[model samples]
Target: MQRIDSVNVRPDVNGAGKPGFHDNADLSGQDATYLTPTWLNTVQEEICNLIEKNGYTLNVASRQQLYDIIATNDSVTALAEAMENRLVQLQAVLATKSALEQGISYVMSELGQHKTASNPHPQYLLASTFGVHIPMTAAIGRTEIKDENRVLGWNGQSSDWTANTGEITWGGSLSGSVEFTPYRAYGQFLLSGYISTATFFDVNVRVFNAEGIETSLIKVTEYGGSYASYGMNKVFEIPKGGKAVIEYRVDAGYSKRAQMTFSVYVDDRVKVFTPVGLTSVVDATDFTESTQNDVKSDYSSFPAFEWFYGDTNGQYFELSAISNMSDPVNKIPHYHRDKFTQLEKDLYIAVQAGKQTIESPSDYAVIDTQILRARTDAEGNVVVAVPLSMRSITTANNETLVYTFVYYLNEPDVTGALPVGLDGEHKIYVRL
Candidate 1:
């Protein structure tokens, strides 16, 4: 008759039928915290078989072994070693211009920021702040489609130039807005004012992001570095693409006069290359698929995509700091006097935006590495067709699909005058 959900019940009768029995020992009976004592005692053999069938022996030794592994892996000493290695890498990268700086305020400023989802390094700025400007130049071309260059002057308060010592003290700060590319932001300062005997200048540079919500970075470098080492990459890398406002101040510095050549050049290390006809050939989903060979078809279709610096058919990847340029007698000379590094690496690809969808040629994508080689045309320019892909978030209205081709050279390091940092960074953006 009556069904009970739960009952405060217990068994009192022994197996011999008398109540309150078994006086010798109750150790022979099996018991479990989960199940009733009657059920456990009846199916003790089945319980052992179930654990054994799972191929794991459930015992105190097994639990102790698992505990030992977790303890060894999550040890404080192992975590400390990993942290120490990361600190060393950061220190090496910052050692260039941060030598005069003491506190790591620059590194700590990025503590609150979160990295990207898939590619933790950086991503391309889509529908960015640039007109229909072409990314390619005439013949030898490697220019960014979107770039910002602002020449800043030391407009802060400063003491009068000391005629006796020829050194003047500078104080206060001056700010300037610069347009940043996706991955790189460069700063070039003409420190001719800082050339004094036994005179050192501690300069603090603070960079803010486009939104100016938080501090992007702050680099403190003595104005005593060499001529070619004035770029912000020597201090730290700024991986933002938009309006970047930077404030420069002299914490402690002497100057002949406030140099007006403080400039920030926004040109990414990643290059944008628009293919000839991609949307007509490949689908947007097929662009990101692993089983595609756009590189092989690039020579006939994507002639604008160039990677290596070869002089086979009279075209070469040329980088010049101060080649074939007029002398700047009024400014201090370092790297490129024009503020921006001029690179001419490939032929110009005329921009052809579609009517239905927009094209973002500056968007960079990762290469599949299987199709990361250059195919030579019939006595034409060398075409390195790198089939690269990025995420395509479908929208309600129109969408822009940007395909990039990035190649990594498997060449060995050369110990010579030519500078080398080509660790799989031959990037090109092609419109699909």
Candidate 2:
């Protein structure tokens, strides 16, 4: 510590045309340290804090006296010690009050233990996931395209397609009118109920933007041979409160022999797609031997079935291409693109209802919550910060929960790119 020869604290005493200047001719007889502006600020702050703690007013006389004493190195050190003690006391009180008011009890309970019944399928519940089965089309000119993305394959025996005459005629007798419904306006009116018969039916599903012009055509395949079933899904994003159209060519089908059913189960109940937690009951059995060892395998064993239903399990869930269209918070992907945190990974594993976490290379977790809060560190590895609510466990024999994650094709930066032409689909798989 250095002793001060004297003290001079004033602003622009002489007309030097500059601020914060000091002259030191009279201070030669005194023992004092010439404190720099930064050091002086530190000393002043400490003194103010001490006075505040003791309930004293910062008067001019007191401030000057303290400034004079702190000119010596010994007093400066003592002042620092006094301020630290008072600051610690103030911090302790503030922390305690903050904890009480913020409802820390609930946060503690959620963090301490794991939750059971994480995933259970409910009865009468609308299908958790939304999807459209796109049958082969004549415009694309290829019926034998590989089903690379969908979990299920097209099991139809024949891919043959024939065009229908524009005129709705059954041997020159038009008994009914053909109604056209656009897919863009689907939310306003949706069709529900199972179509009992698998017959060759023609329905022109149209989509439009704000201009009301037809944007795309999703043609439903004519299901003919062996009582087969074929469908199409048209997914797009529109402005808020904007509309689309679905024109069903109800008259073009072979309806004279049998009335083919075109059931459209439409409602707002169809929620946005979610990624199931890896430890969820529906995802419990999705893990494989390779996944347990953290080894990357060609075939990742994802959650294909729930344990409660035993070995008779298969994937079954509807898909809606309009995930980001809903504008719901969690319906879209999270901002973070990093690896999972310890707490997040633990919560994911703990929330699995009936599934057990297995150590295998094929095993992975699915995120099923509609919303996600994810973050990343300096490293760019992807991880989930928020835990998602998952599907429920099922007791039905061979019934399985389907894992759903969005796949971005071609443009990773774009949220609603179609999965048709990209390098397959960017699908994230998990089981619960």
Candidate 3:
């Protein structure tokens, strides 16, 4: 009538023949039931079916292969741990894929809008539009004196003088004097003269200033016996209200007579006006005239800005030297104010700022090409066709947004660990 515990049963014998079940009893025999063993086998089969349904091929029937895969763990623990590890890997892969998708979406949407979120500092755009100046071309006036004259100093006398309208003919025996029409204003004069026979003779031309002092002297000595013609050209600066007299003197030579003819030209053309904030002088006594009388000026002493002869219009002269002149002569205001529209100012500012933003040589090259493609007038003044803020929307906005995305994406996670595959050493497998 007492209940027997199953733990007290022996495996080898039947309960009716023995006080307890025999430990060596065969449960597979016809007299016994293998219910627990059957249930355990059924659970193992179910587990194998579940693994197969979940897209995994497991050789559960081959205990050796299963043991090889899960070498150091029990069968159930090994299988569960492997599945959990694989699931963790899958989650990491999915996270990375989602981040990429979101990043790409953000880039495409920002680019599609063709603009950024409202610029917090709209003043940068406004500053570009206000008070932009561009250079303009203005017609500069110029003049040259082509007037011709022939004046003889005297009819027959060498010392006494009278104006005669003929070439001055003098034997090497007699010297003569001739005068050019006095220049009314400060100007440059080009004098050209020729001597018929300069053989075995001493010929000299002296330029006397308004004060009757010899300012320039030119003398040519003849050494050959053959009669040859000599020509010379000289440039001289005549002061305002100044008169110049050229005295020709020649010693009597073997040649019977020598003919001399001279001509003068005055150039009053203004090549370029002195720029603003500078001083200039015309026919100043401070500089001397060298034989190389081309229209070159050295204004190193009176520096700020200077207009030399033959200067191009609208040329920018970099400041080099400072002026020490306590009182500069002929100082004049010469700079003209340049004006620009709002759009033009924006374009100019964009180009200027873009150039300054270049951080490398490659960037500089790209920016230079872009600037060249920008519109410009014949005078090299920038022209604006559209608002500069709208130009190169993709390049400009992408530069900013992509930079931010990459910077933040590269940052470490909350645990101070990099993404599973981005630790610089791990390999990642992406599904799509």
Candidate 4:
């Protein structure tokens, strides 16, 4: 597969001035020199026919052709409108195909060990591997400054801190704590919940380990003189053989009710190796045939751009003017051209981020003409970073050129056969 750098059609305009498209003809005219209504209808019908012939699917090349038409004749009101609508529908199909391909690639890359004939669905295996959900009780256990009127529960109701018949004269503070045990070993743990408060007070929430050591999870100190609500999603590592303790505090001088509901989800203990021990380690010197084949196949299938639209061919009928569109001399001012250019870069980044990664420091390969670097951290987490220079696009810009490029890649088979050795000598544990 080949990678694309810039889809800029104009060579004369340098830097940010290039509109990335060419003006073939005055689309505002109805003459034969411009795109006629008859030509536009014919092209639309032909594209529709091609899509129907291909089982209502447009290949990467066909989609690019349509995008070329849309880009070149976008100034033609009626023709551009029709093609734009069709392009949107086609893009939807392409997006779905892209998602399916990415999903299959992920299963093939990440859960290759779990692929089996007996359980052909890798997703189910993946779910069983890391879908352990041990629901913790969200009830508030104890409080520091307790009051009889203060209420706390996990029944989706407001936990109130009210004065005892105007005893404190709208000034008081309350705190509570809860403790729960984790179900598994070390993994990513997510704590998500929301808190609603009234009478304009400050709320602080924290999580502590089994040793009474506080882990700073959530803290809100700013107070507005009205009701306020907050939502939190915090991810933390759960140490081996340890539990979590949740603590919350509310301070206010007026009548305030703070309602909070939270839950914890711990990642399941799914190991890359069956028996996670020293014996499970393989000798670095020994390379099997299957291992060599796997490495070769991965290198052979590295994702790349299969096709790209550099110019408008099918949409612009006048061959001479259309050919001259890429010339550096004939330049047209397009205000939104930079915005479209940025969008192209963004799309490339998104695709590369989803699919590509650096294996080592020396492997400096470019994808879609941009260099991406990946490094493993101290905790063995791969962090992929792409260098970006920000350029702002605003509606205030008057001269802008818009060019469209449609990228299409072959979708992988979602219902394909699973890999061998999926049902190896390991017990499949399902979460209840």
Candidate 5:
């Protein structure tokens, strides 16, 4: 008796019944047990269960509906993710927009540029070659143009006043146009100049725009006859920017004329605030678990920080950073430093850093509604404080920590004389 392979050599029925009757009986049916037909059936059920667990129903009878919903929901989720990514970008744009609306500039520049980040105005310089230093005391009470007063004139187009007017013509100053630009909102200029009486005669100043329109006389008084050693100083404001002509008219006014000079100092409307470094340490794994309040112990222990202005533009949250890192101005924090105490330095550091963070939520944070009221202390300095709350974050090891933060009022960018219309009628004089 010999053993035969059951897979390829099946029992030969013909060999038993009839001699030499060979037949190749099919063995394909035996291979049918390799895998269960229902193996893939679980895949559909798994997909259906996934949808159902997510508050969706997958009815195989309505395959179209299931696919449609899956695609629709996928598209919606994709859109949501895209929107979240755009949130920060949109906030930056909105902040810039806010600054612009308040006549603020977002572009940074060097000092003395007289240009705001968002606004740049006309830049003026005096030609050094002109010998126009006037003696002191040439300007006195109620002085007008008279003989023997050496005038200091500017044509705006050139540094050579003598060449253009052929010896300082009274009305020969070349007129330049004054155009309105965005930086005009930051500040204005009114200038006045005259010859000193100590080494000179009399001096009077007048301003004219590019349109040949001369503004009203701003400095009409004379400084001569009494104060002979003091040079004249005048500060004024010009509302517009363009070619400005300063007329150096003079008066003999019972004094000798001296060499004259003029200069301008501008006050900018917007400024930059530098950021103090992060006082709190955030765990890389879970941001929500990172407590910020614990890092800053007190105002004295914390690094100084500053904030410029920002716009909301109907947003739920906004993030701002301090870019200026030099010469941080001392400011009264919304919360007093002597008030709180913690055993760990990290705890105080976290609190100070957290206080500066800005956020917008569906509802106001409990810490945002408080106000920073200021009162003059015995030292004549303003002290500000606000109401605040504490929050705790627990780690996986069951250790819990707390952070403190304060609520305060937000100041807008465009702030001025608070009563709105009170300063509207105020006027300052500009000479050139």
Candidate 6:
């Protein structure tokens, strides 16, 4: 785009009485004397020509750019300063973008017939209208209030649901089986067995689905004749009307008496769980109504997910989309400092990709676990020019924290930024 124009050779006139003006008498015969004034001038012109040809020649339109680079342009117009200015501009743009994105962090990703399963709970989610529970909703701290909470299941009383087999005589590697069915949604199951006159017999245990399919199997090395029974927890998700069958068999042909039992129970926990699709119903379109709504109140079909049961209902719409410690993807973005989205006023989920979607409260899990999972999304064929996501969060509440400080009583009264006073007492520090 730019180039320098070349100038031909040229030199100033020579001095009047310069040396070698003539073949001097003393140095007359030197190799090429006096190269006279004309000759000297000619050679000087040739050197000047070479210099002109060697130099860069440009026909630049903006010669002022060259002037600024070659001459210090007040230090402010240099390339480094220009770069710094551009960086400042870029940072300003990025800061604005981050503020805006975070402002709407818990908001729905998209609109249209969207559906989510928080706030009102899936049981109370209206069928015709899409509903979701999102950050800062009314249900933010009420996850433990549902009837399905494990703490609610135990009243310091014996479990209302447990099945067992009494001692029975059997021989020739005989097996015993026990089955238990639930009338309502329940979780927290355990397995244990006893044997009479075991005499160190090898045993095999198994679990089966309703279709009599063996879903899991395990072997035990020995069972003693002692009265102590072996116990194990976290059986599996067992839905209502669905029966779980467990069977135990001994390897020896010795005649022995044996029994097995399984129970649904829970222990004391710092956290609680809730049932889905089961929220308080109100008549007004706004869920804050005083009267009960005539629509979507039947919770008979809502699946109650127990805490420690892993994730949400598989055959259902799941996840609070509510901001919790592990699943903080949904929370009140801000109170006075933040703004809430209108998935209908800080409500439920908006599946990023699909709109016409259906989620039922997960009935049961196919895995053995006790911890409720974080808000999870199904993996899919999602590819984008710029991939992004968000997860809400706060401090975990599983336990409490305490701090301590120590000081010696005999040190000198040290002053001004010392670790301890001269009296040996340590100084307390408050961080800014």
lDDT of 4 by residue, 1-432 (tens): 111123323444345643333452444532222334555677676776554433245456564644444455543576668799899867765778786687577657656655545535433343344443223222222211232212212111222221111111112233455544433333344555555553333334454443445665655343543446666555555444444545544432222324444444323222222221111111112112222111100111111211111223322111111211122112221110001211111111111101112223323222232221121122222211121210122223222212211211222222322112211111111111
lDDT of 1 by residue, 16-83 (tens): 42233233245456332233455555466455544544334667546453344335655556778989
- lDDT tens string, model 5, 370-398? 11222222222221222222212223432
Who is ahead in lDDT, 3 or 5?
Answer: 3
Question: Could you report the Cα RMSD, in angstroms, for every candidate shown?
Answer: 29.6, 33.6, 49.4, 33.4, 34.6, 39.5
Q: lDDT: which candidate is best? A: 3
**TM-score per candidate, chains pooled:** 0.18, 0.18, 0.22, 0.22, 0.19, 0.20
Residue 210, candidate 5: Cα error in Å is: 6.5
* Tens digit of per-residue lDDT, candidate 3, span 1-432: 222224444533435544333433444543323235545667676666455544356864665543444454565686899899989867765778786687678657644443464533232222222212111111112222233221112111111122211221211233455554231223455555556554333444455554444677655333334446676455555444343455553321221234444544433222222122211212212112222211111122222332111123534332211211222222111111112232211111111112112224323212211111121122323311112222233343322110000011122342322233211221111110
Model 6 stretches with alpha carbons more than 4 Å out: 1-164, 169-174, 184-188, 200-214, 218-243, 250-264, 267-432
Candidate 1 residue pairs that clash: 140-344, 141-345, 141-346, 273-429
Candidate 2, run of 10 with poorest lDDT:
277-286
**What 10-residue stretch in candidate 3 is worst by lDDT?**
400-409
Give candidate 5 regions above 4 Å deviation.
1-187, 190-202, 208-211, 223-227, 249-257, 269-432
Worst 10 residues of 5 by lDDT: 163-172
Give lDDT for model 2.
0.29
> What TM-score number comes out for model 1?
0.18
Stretches off by above 4 angstroms in model 2 are 1-199, 224-241, 250-256, 261-432
The whole-model lDDT of each prediction reads 0.28, 0.29, 0.32, 0.32, 0.28, 0.29
Query: Tens digit of lDDT per residue, candidate 6, span 48-112?
Result: 44333333334345444444434565544666787998898677657787856754553343221
Tell me how many clashing residue pairs each candidate has: 4, 72, 11, 8, 59, 33
**RMSD in angstroms between candidate 4 and the native structure over all alpha carbons:** 33.4
